[model samples]
Target: MDPYLLNAPWVNTLRLVLEVAATVAFALSGVMAAARKRLDAVGVCVVAFVAAFGGGTLRDLLLDQRPFFWIRHTEFVWGILALCIGAMLFMRQRHFEPTERAMLLPDAIGLGLFAAVGVDIATAIGMPPIISVMMGVTTGVFGGVLRDVLCNEVPQAFSDHRPYALCAFAGGWADVALRQVQAPDWAPLVACVVLTAGLRGLAVWRNWELPAWRV
Candidate 1:
């Protein structure tokens, strides 16, 4: 694949799509968390916005990108707000249970999507591979960290003893590896998303856990 293709308009469009999807995923996770905590509508909206934008905002700041991603993409703001309202109404109408278990899928999805976007953006800016990977990890994990803190719980990325950030880390490497070999522009992104989310879902299904540190 031509290196220039990475910056092609279609690639940018795909990145925007991934970002939008990831935002929606994390926003839903926040909505579920707020609902589980029995927060009011304003609280729900706040949490959802935080979960949706927290990681990406931090990524933008670290990259020294002005205006932040949400600020530049105002529709994303409106969309998340509408999503919060619709999600709340739908859950209430359906008597949906907003359990921790219910939040995992969307959280995993957001993690993968954000990780890919973070890595790609960093790489485009000519960051070293390790730095790009770390950016991916940061983008993947930070949002949920903020969400859990707001909910007065330990961030599951640390406490769950499952491979949350680890999944993102590995997915980041997979992306870097693909780019090294000049794979198709979209291949790295897809591989990162699938590997990260698939690993997370598998870990949940298998009840896999990393060994806990003993005092």
Candidate 2:
């Protein structure tokens, strides 16, 4: 990977944009889950915060980075809080049913955006391709895992049997491959997001599932 390509100012801007979008997408998914559970306002906010920040927080910890991402960008905290309040009010006023199906779109989008951001960051830090891919998967999937655990259900990533994390894994590899070939600086990120989200959306629409273990 050419270090200069990833370090460009516009590429940095793109990464920041991806991170913000991913945060909002995951936060919305958390809101839907809380609503589906008929939780109170505080519960809604808590779940939203966890879903928004959990994965990135874990990644930062493992990377030994100072000042967790959200801490470094305190506005993320306020944004999620505002999103929670607005989502709750809008859902209630519109009599919207926050079904599981309703949550899938945002979850898939967040997975893709987070996966791209993760791979880019890891690659920029000179991590090996395998490690970068794992970081992407972690950043994409762990927050939803934490969300489901908080909601008192087995994580859908593990239990749904759909191609959730697999999408991220494939996209991560795509990102790495593109960088290896010296594709345009933005190509990896765009390819990662599109391929990951497209695969996940297709899986959900087609009701595709991985084989479950037999006892």
Candidate 3:
């Protein structure tokens, strides 16, 4: 067994909490995308499942891990299903419209949590630093990218130019640095979450964007 995978009960508890938070956040973002597209209940569940598991599925594949997360933990799928159903019911009852801005916070939070978890998983598998960081970015952004594509919009991670993946990259490096400094297991996760989400939120609030390139 990998030493990194072995931890105290409280550490496992924290990891579970972070995982649930990230899953719920990404699932909500997917639900919002479905709402914006006026998707039916089936479409909503599909989008939410993709958004919640897409990145982690890819990460597990790249890591060559067995029992993909959703398969290993059936609850994740059930949770997304329940979330989509409830969100759809609530929105329908209230006749509420979901805006792009409404998606931002959840997206940011998901990005941060996924990024941190990605790095942790990669390092646990003894991957190199650069590869681990890249994995972190992939785990953070790919779900949202898939969601946007399914929604028939340009992926915000690519087109919005608001430093989305870059935020994840920075957070990944921060996680690595904290680990190098022998920080507690929870510290790196907390730092990564804060940095990634904070940077994303600030970018949106300040209208910060990368300059568009002329062809």
lDDT of 3 by residue, 35-147 (tens): 88888889899988888888988888899977887887898888888888888879879978777777788778888999998998898888988899999998988988899
Segments in model 3 whose C-alpha atoms lie over 4 Å from true places: 1-5
Global local distance difference test of model 3: 0.86
> What's model 1's overall lDDT?
0.89
Candidate 3: TM-score?
Answer: 0.92
The alpha-carbon root-mean-square deviation between model 3 and the true structure, to one decimal in Å, is 2.0
Model 2, runs deviating above 4 Å: 1-3
**TM-scores for every candidate against the unseen true structure:** 0.91, 0.92, 0.92
Residues 106-165 of candidate 2 have per-residue lDDT tens digits of 778889999998887787778999999999999999988898999998997898788999
For model 2, what is the C-alpha lDDT against the true structure? 0.88
* Residue-wise C-alpha lDDT for candidate 1, range 56-135, written one tens digit per residue: 78888899978888889898889998999999889878988767786778778888999999999899888999999999
Model 1 alpha-carbon drift over 4 Å, by segment: 1-3
Local error of candidate 2 at residue 119 (angstroms): 1.0
